[model samples]
Target: MNTTTQPTHNTLFITCFAALVATSFCFVLRAFVVDDWGHEFNLSATQKGELLGVGLWPFSISIVLLSLLIDRVGFRAVLWVAVACHLIGTTTTLLATGYWSLYVGTFVLALGNGAVEAAVNPLIATAYRHDKTKWLNMLHAGWPGGLVLGGLLALAQGGGVDWRWKIGLVIVPVIVYSILLLRQRFPVSERVAAGVSYREMLAEAGYVSALIVAALIVIEVGRVFDWSLLLQGLLIVAATAFYAWYTRSPGRALFIIMLIIMMPLATTELGTDSWITSLLEPEVVSMGLQPGWVLVYTSALMLVLRLFAGPLVHRFSPLGLLALCSAIAAVGLYGLSQATGVAVLLAATIYGIGKSFFWPTSIGFVAEQFPKGGAVTMNVLAGVGMLGVGIVGSVLLGTIQDRAIGHSLAAHDAQHATQLHATYFTSEKTGVFGRYLALDEAKVNASDAQTRAVVDAVVAGSKKTALKSVAVLPLIMLAAYLLLLLYFRRQGGYRAVALTQSPPAA
Candidate 1:
């Protein structure tokens, strides 16, 4: 029972919006400042990948843990934890000197981001139960909204600002959300308010979903501790067996299927977006566009489209809209891979429109289809997506670019290749870490004319090849979405599941 005075819907909406802004603010900063970090620290590609991925993987931990606890501990308490993490994370980031400190700071920052999603998603659902999809899309518009603000600020700095100032963007939103959320009443989760038992909520996530989360945890933890793969594999197997025995219900198979699909969906969109600025920098510069402007443009497209998702959802249906968007995004990505000069804008617009609706619409689909699953369902889906980006997407993008560039450079100048390899590449684990090459922006800029020409060719080729590879993910998602549309169609079209309220105890 929520005993405190209920907050106005306007206040909650604004606060939730701010929380997402802060989240995106943290995420988008990597695009602007990661090269700076690499240059300053002489970090390898593996180290940079770890650094950026740290900013994401911890999201999985915080969201999964908080999802299980939020209903029990209450929304206010979980929000305060988010605030604390943000403050602490910012302090760590400002003080960071090298690889270890930067990783810790990013990890802490991601914890707060995950907590925000865990709290706010359910908050909005409880606040505007009838319009979860529309409100959620509107709430999520803040993601690209933050990107626009952050990207413009980076561009204004002429891409030369202190990394600290760029990172400080989150502070304003943190303070605003804190003020808006404090002392306000928080409703019980829809599941709790409707008198659904706690056990039922846990069961909705199921053993399979739990196994996936657990396996990711093992993979991440093993990476940090330098644990052997054999050891990690055994731990994951044990976790799977334990969850299978623990969860008696076969669980919501359809929801579980969506969770699986979320891996590629998340990796393809957020992962690709994270690298957009760097990948397109050469072409954008050649065309006299500010490098960061392309990101701002794409983000603006997403912000506008998400704000109007209500009508589109009504017309196309959520799954139908996703299928259409996936096809467009695939074409956009392929177009981007092949684009040059001012042609990049057209390609970006298509990509932006394609990716804009993916994250929020997917959330809406799960919410509408599995309302009985409650916070766990929503938060786990979110957790899976974040983990995918942090673990698979970030590392994969970084590694492929490194390898492609290395391959190109090796063929161009063997001596320069040696220098570049010494400067950029490093060895780490097999799966995500592998061999990474981190190019130095300062070094590349200062190279002699012949050397600069060679470097340019390598970067351009690597980026194009990487984009073409990632375009495959959206193509896969298109097929999956189409199949889901057919599934829903056969079942009398998409419909929201409404749990019947239990009468109060006599």
Candidate 2:
């Protein structure tokens, strides 16, 4: 489907389009399977999160390396090779059991993912230059759409399924994609612009290039680390004024802060990851569905939203939409924590809808705004930014999970130590979002009166303690992202963010 000689109106467009879907299909299952990974592999939350972050490390490195590669080689070569890497990585996850093996697998996987992202994203931007944001959103939507499918599998086959099988789901697509890509030819970045040589396109002002690269690097690294999401959020409320003296541009800092502001809110609000089974156990029983169906239904809803992502982005500004959706995510998470029986079903649906926009939209926004010469630099930045989110989310959620479990263990009677271990293990099995780990399900088995009494008591005690502890994070993140968002906007001024100002556009 992907062809070289002619413009992207046909071949190139279709290849990149399929590539995006394939890439999304491969990557969307991480959050769903993360906790189960720990359970299957016998790793801790810290271990799982770190391993996940390491999987993300390739994203950071790829940004720098791939950027340079895009200028030298071309998009088609990089895209297919990336697909090949994804196929290999996809298969590798099936066989990994030990921590090191898993880490290595993830490392390889991230590289493939980063490659796909690096190559196809910019290609999309260039292919639909007139409406970059719209196309990018449609492109990004593929990720969540994939996630939705994976989520269904996770439900139909809970995390308990052999990790290898879940991974193989991605491989089928990659093999098919490789066949398609091999059959088709496409233009390299150099060929995108008529008469532009690769060498000439690579040349740009030292000062401008430095700033541009630095900004790209910062965003890539920052998004991966997600430090500002917490730090900046806190800066917004702190009267002590640490933020005022911390940097030159507070607005850009705040933008990053906003990106993650709802994280804490969402964590407690949804209560799905760690407490998913517990939250829906009674309902699952009532509906005559397996416990895992909760995850499936949620994932299904998520996919439905994503498949329609282009239209959504066209109507709602990604940032503005996320802000509203985050508010909704917050409420959905909160509703889940508070709901019972039928209430939970409604809340889960809402939560899925809210979460649907946050990730893909963010990716699209970054791609549309900042262009670094060719597919390489720009794609690297996008990859790094998402990696930054991975890193930040892992660290933040891991700490909370640990602290909560430690408290729950210490709170239990000595006999519950075994129970505590089981709980801890359950949470660990869930990965980063495993904060509540197994604790959320602890009181679910009692009779209605007893369950209500225990839920009420736990809500009165640990939930209060847990919410208080987590609240500190987003407050800090708000200020940081707000500043960062504003700074980037100011940097662009009146010019549209998508225009890559290289000497010769690649």
Candidate 3:
């Protein structure tokens, strides 16, 4: 377990980084092609959000489940599962016939993504135990690297190439990473090497964290299958009760607070990324620019910044950096809500820099603060973030767009709005928030050019409003990070906890 002496350390790190790059390939490709799927499947905005969310939320299931078992099962085995999932999910998506097929494909892909993180996060954390935060940030550079590369590749394909072909590109990195990693020797996790018992690791997360994750799973799954309220509640209770009985702890207070903070943080970063291409489509297209370029541009910035995070973490400390980034992100999101023409790129630059460190730094914080929790603490934090963005953030943003468009259309032209509602907005969808009517894509397409123009204008406004609505998320995160900064300051100063040392008292 002496990481410095491990011969495969650098190669394994590269392989892990490549695996994450493969995951981001799936993400960026899906983000770019979501509109194509919407058109082909005649999907509403909400349905499109569901497609995007499926590409994310299912990540939680595989990551959380696999994290708990990875120590016993080994990293290579879990990565092999990820490889299989990638191939199968890509194949399914390529052959998709409609919304349901696309949903299944994305859901399976998310599972593969989760598996990759479950293996790589702890693998890298253990590999660079002495410099966990710095190395983790360096490792996560692959995410934005893939985003930049994948986004550019998709953009290069232009309007002529089929979306299926773009999706198939995910297999390239998959093949490369699999070849590099499958034959490599895996390392013992730091927790196991330190003789941290299974019970002790479980205590690091405990029942409170378990309850939050369990509840989100139940709620999201219940929504999908139309499960009764009673069933969902019972499932949540049973799951939490079992965990509490076994762990006999409420979880550390700071870990729980971090878990809560993850929701808004994930929504601000991943959720915004999920919708950015579509949200800015009208503005970008009007300026004769491709919407995907904004994503590519932002990702390139992130890629470069993350590669240099070691210095930044040193200067600001982890919590201080998070607090600073949260405020920057809030400003950036608000700027994006109002930016137009060439200014959009400027806004995106700020937003990209702000979000660049959020994911990796958060992981670093959890890994440093709760090393005894091992993969469970790190991956659970990631899983909950994905769950939050998938079930709530993505879908809620779509709902906001739909509602705003509906309201805008009504206020603009009441008679026309009523006519359009009767014709196009015929689908009634219910989500966690409540029931709302969504515009049917097929019906919208069948409308006259003038009607389409009017609808487009309304949609453009609504998209901006959606961005504005989401701007609040980062503000919430800023407040939370500030409070955490205060809490750490009162305790003397923020410091990365070591495995041999005890974590701060709850």
Candidate 4:
């Protein structure tokens, strides 16, 4: 880590941007092709949600695990690992034959995505330490930028193109970033540069945050392996005890609060994006527009706004901006639930603007507020956000849609509902939230046109209702952000904490 010979800031920033573009390409493409997977795999809505969830939750594991080792391992080494994961993950996805194959592929892909964030986030924060929020926002513009590109490319191929070809698009950016970063000198992290001890860095996250992350990992892993509840509980307890003994602290109160807030915040942003196309499909189709256009259009909005986040941060302050956006997001989601046809675009505009800053700004806030935590605090927040959405949010929304459709159909036409239930509905399936039945796509496809029509109408209404259900998440976020704003005002004002050479008293 020599300072003089390291790559210029612009060069490193561009390389980081390219790496993020590669990750976002995978995300948007998978989201676009999810319906295709549902058709091919004869999946229930819950199962489709599981696929999407797996694509995200595994991100937490790789990110948290790698964050612990990144400072010791160096950025170049960790990035090369990410590059390998990307290649293997994409190849696995391309060769998929069924749901299990798709699951494995997506799981691997998420690991690569996690690794990318683990390396790049701290890299940018270190490069522009004085103005982390602005540079980090600029760094993340690459995400929506990739989405806009990937979504448009997928859309351009028309509906008739093979999904395998669409998935292959991820490889192009992967190659581009790998080439850009090749042989580039990397810098020591801000924590290291500031002479912050590793023990102090671990102290910032403390025991409580570690327990939350550990519990999530244990629960999800247990579910995957069908581990007994006793085993899962023991693992969580053991992990928490070790962390508490070592850290001897409950964690900073504000940082702990932020971690809790991340759950709904993540659901409102990434969870909704994951399902937007499917949720709005019927309305968008009726208007003779591709469902994907909505995702691309919203992503485009996010891209432009994120590029200009500096002024907003300066004007509203990070927490203030977050509070305002959460309110807008709540309104936007409710509007989406009620909007129809062309009006859907208008509602999406508000949502696009509202969610545009949530992810990057939240990261910027964590990096600024907890600079002593270095990559661990920032990446852990990100990991927790993904874990929350993947295990809870995405699956919960799908379950909501499933339950709503069943009830709506039964109420509308009991005899038809009974027949459909006997013939087309899946048996009860269990998820993180609870057990629920879902429509079996294969059987539904085999039903008569009249049956399909009735089911489709019910399905559309259910999707809308699901959006309304999710609207509560942003409202929850709004309350949390407002409280944070009030707390910061009482402390004189919001300000980024600067690291000093000597560690502050514990």
Candidate 5:
């Protein structure tokens, strides 16, 4: 009934295009806002984490809201409303000189960004019905694509522009997309096309349940993305027995549980897919080179990879490609955790390439299996990813850093676990005492104070770094997703074997 070669009339294309812009805007805003505000806010550790989480928070909230709203009004209305919110939010950020204002503005921007996803994700399924998963991958890849642009600008040119100018920069993309959507005529959802009821639309996101399962897995095993052998063994037996009774494989149980483990992993991976610019600062500092520039180069490659993702997914089978990519990412993240200097910079770049396709492939896999609920799945995946950034950053990574290098370094990032008031991230701000508690270790190595100073320093630093760098959890999760991708290759296209092959004759 519908046929169009170009995206000109492709509702998904136009809406996805807009979604791409919105996604890019959200990450870009998040990427730079942290750096700019860090300078302006002189923020405490808790404030900084909260500030960063603001970008992630609105996204999660928007996902739930969008899931419910799209079932009612459909996408066009949601898309426009989202764009309007982003515009207002971005514009208001210029007025922010304090915490609450900045929070409100960033949240509004995320709201709009979240809304874009609500529309485009389901739109991808509805539009490209056959390749819903592939298209969804392509569509969601827009996020890393946006991050590519966002990070490049923020890291490379960030110093020259004021935060106001940075916020202003989004206006161009916003205006261009608004114009494109205006010119295009869109369509109703796949549910509308097939005459399915709204109740079914709600159930479409089987992957959302899957995401919850994966989120739990990540929490339980502490393995970012790999399946716990124990969990998998239990699932295999359960699924086999369950399938003996019903026509449909009861694997959905495993899928849901998997999300509990994997959703957080995926989200953590993406959040940390950020530029290497924020690598911890040593006590002795200089202006000559900042890690941000390293991030710029890494982000540039990320953009380039995303642009080619359409073809890559076509060739490698999305899941296989993701596994390979994630393996590369795992090495990168672990390496970053342990390495330093230019070597660390190089590792981050390697991590970047590995990270390039993790989300796209995973999102694509979900879209293929759970077309109707793609938006909800995307939200869960995306939302959990945001929260992963917070949790791993606030909890996991901080603990590791404290134990390994917190006391050795000039900064002791932890010191909060000692208090009953322990929230997500509180130690990174407790002040010079925290710093000296760790730094004084070098001076007192021979003094009677050595034992107490070092012990105190490690605890505090671990806490601090755990919160500071939990974003790495997602990067590690990417590796886990990659393995899962290999397992699910049949469900999507692109097998593991093909990942190693060169592109076929065009």
Candidate 6:
């Protein structure tokens, strides 16, 4: 056993919030630099998707492992590991020369990210056990705040700035958080404080939820790497056996269901946020607005709104509020797909508001419904959300854009398509939509005026198509929220569970 004086609740809260800001900075950093990597590496759309997802899926590995071990290892120790990962990961990324190196860098960075969430989510929940939703929202306000700051920094650097230097910006937040967290002592998780056993906490997650998340991560990795059928089968069987052995309780069906729902919710939020700047670039350029500003604008709205989520949660109830957001976000995405000129602002506003509460509110819900589940439940849920965007959402959206562009061009300019086909398309590898064209920089640079125009039209159309396609995700979320709202209504109303709070001095 280890003993250390816990830091004040306010101090821990601020440190965790800074950690999240650093994490969020890492999340959006790629979106700004991906095109540069594409040009330098001759990356295909699918490859770019893989790059985006790389920052996410590895998070699950670290979070899952650490969530199980955090109680034994101590939070401060795990956090120091996180700090090292961030420093080394950023250095690795800056020094990267090729695809594999970049992949390694991103994967390591995600390890730090996962570690942060695993340590901090439970820290904040325990620190403010009585008002988990409100404080959690306040803590998560760091995400959008970081995005807005990063967006502006990207803008000030201008589009022509070096990718390495742009990525180096994250070092600032990493240092800020490090200074804040390095010496602070962490409080025990609420469950541990309340004398809840590890087995009881593990049982709250159960075999069903664990199995579902495990399968999704396995399938995503397998799909990306083209794992052999036997390998996939073995992994599935292993996961099944482990979860079956560990989980004894019947489990909370609603909590398990929410884990699955988090996939689409993540897709609707982070996935969309990842692509929004690229998706709106053509319109933003035409309207004399910087593409980065669109992200900044949306993220600004998210920052402000999330800070005030407490009142909204109080008025609408979490499920009811989420249902309302779903409707607005679905409509907003569809409108964004169709919008031109100033109308883009209107659509983005709605979308930002919709996503603002998703990640934090979901965490709050798990804390309320299954306080006994402890850090494992919270980390698993956060891990799944990240994987949802990185593995499924980002990858699928990239493929959608690839196919949409290829198809539109094939229909209108078969000769040019044939030329591009010979230059870029491979018959052996089909993406989610169809055969993908490797985005060859040389060929693109050499295209004639008319060919370039045709390519631009195809790209513009494809981006729009991608936006319209993703709009469906929020519609699906709206339905899920409605079901949850009705369920809560039947149960009387939304009420947060009170766990063991920190002592008076804390």
Estimate every model's Cα lDDT from 0 to 1. Answer: 0.82, 0.52, 0.90, 0.89, 0.54, 0.81
Q: Which residue pairs in candidate 3 have backbone atoms (N, alpha carbon, C) closer than 3 angstroms, thus clashing?
A: none
For residues 1-506, could you state the per-residue lDDT of candidate 5 as single tens digits?
33434564365475576567656766655655564575575444334445555565456557656766775676667878877987898878878878778878877887787677667766666567666545665565566556556656555554667767666666766776777677565655555455544445445434334334344334423332345668665754553444333322222442344345454555445445332333333310133564455455565666677766777777776656665775676677666656545665666677778767766566566655554443565556555555555444433332344334433432332343332112212234322112311122222233456445544444443433442355455455555656565556556643321111122232
Cα error of candidate 1 at position 486, Å: 1.2
Clash count of each predicted structure: 0, 59, 0, 0, 52, 0
Q: Output the TM-score of candidate 2.
A: 0.66
**Ten-residue region with minimum lDDT total, candidate 3:** 497-506
Q: Any residue pairs clashing in model 1, and if so which?
A: none
TM-score of 1: 0.93
The sequence of per-residue lDDT tens digits that candidate 1 reaches over residues 1-506 is: 54423456677788889888988888888777876787787665546666778888899899989998998898888888999999899889989998788989999999999999999888888777787888899999999999998788777877667888888877877897889777566666778777877778877888889888889889987988889999999999897777667666656988888898888888778888777887888889889877778889999999999999999998998888889988999999999999997789999999999999898888888888888788889989989988988888877877788788777766665754356545533333344655334566666666688777767778778888888888998888889888988888899888888866553253
Across 1-506, the per-residue lDDT of candidate 3 in tens digits comes to 34445568988888999999999999999999999998888887888888889889999999999998999999999999999999999999999999889989999999999999999999999988888888899999999999999998899999768899899999999999989975787778888887888888988999999999999999999988999999999999999999898889888899999999999899999999999999999889988988998899899998999899999999998888888888888888888999999888888888998998899899999999999899999999999999999999999899999998788866766754356656666777766677878877777788899889877888899999999998898888888889988988999998888876222332
Global lDDT of model 5: 0.54
Cα error, residue 236 of model 1, in Å, equals: 2.6
Which numbered prediction scores highest in lDDT against the true structure? 3
Indicate whether candidate 2 or candidate 6 has the larger lDDT: 6
Which parts of model 5 are misplaced by more than 4 Å? 1-15, 152-161, 204-251, 254-258, 280-287, 314-316, 390-506
Native-referenced Cα lDDT, model 4: 0.89
Residue-wise C-alpha lDDT for candidate 2, range 1-506, written one tens digit per residue: 12334353456556665665666555545544665676556555456556656555565456556766774676667776777678677767777767777777777777777777777666766666666666665566555555556556655665357656666777755766577677665443422353444333333211223233344345434443554755534433342233233322222322233323433333332223333443345555556665545655665676566656666665655555555565566556556556656776787787667666655555555444434334533443454444444444444444455555555555663544434344322532334343344433323333367444543353234332333444343334334445544665777632335443234433
What C-alpha lDDT, on a 0 to 100 scale, does residue 458 get in candidate 5? 44
Q: Model 1, stretches more than 4 Å misplaced? A: 1-7, 414-449, 503-506
Task: Check candidate 4 and list the clashing pairs.
Answer: none
**RMSD of each predicted structure:** 2.7, 9.0, 2.8, 2.2, 10.2, 3.1
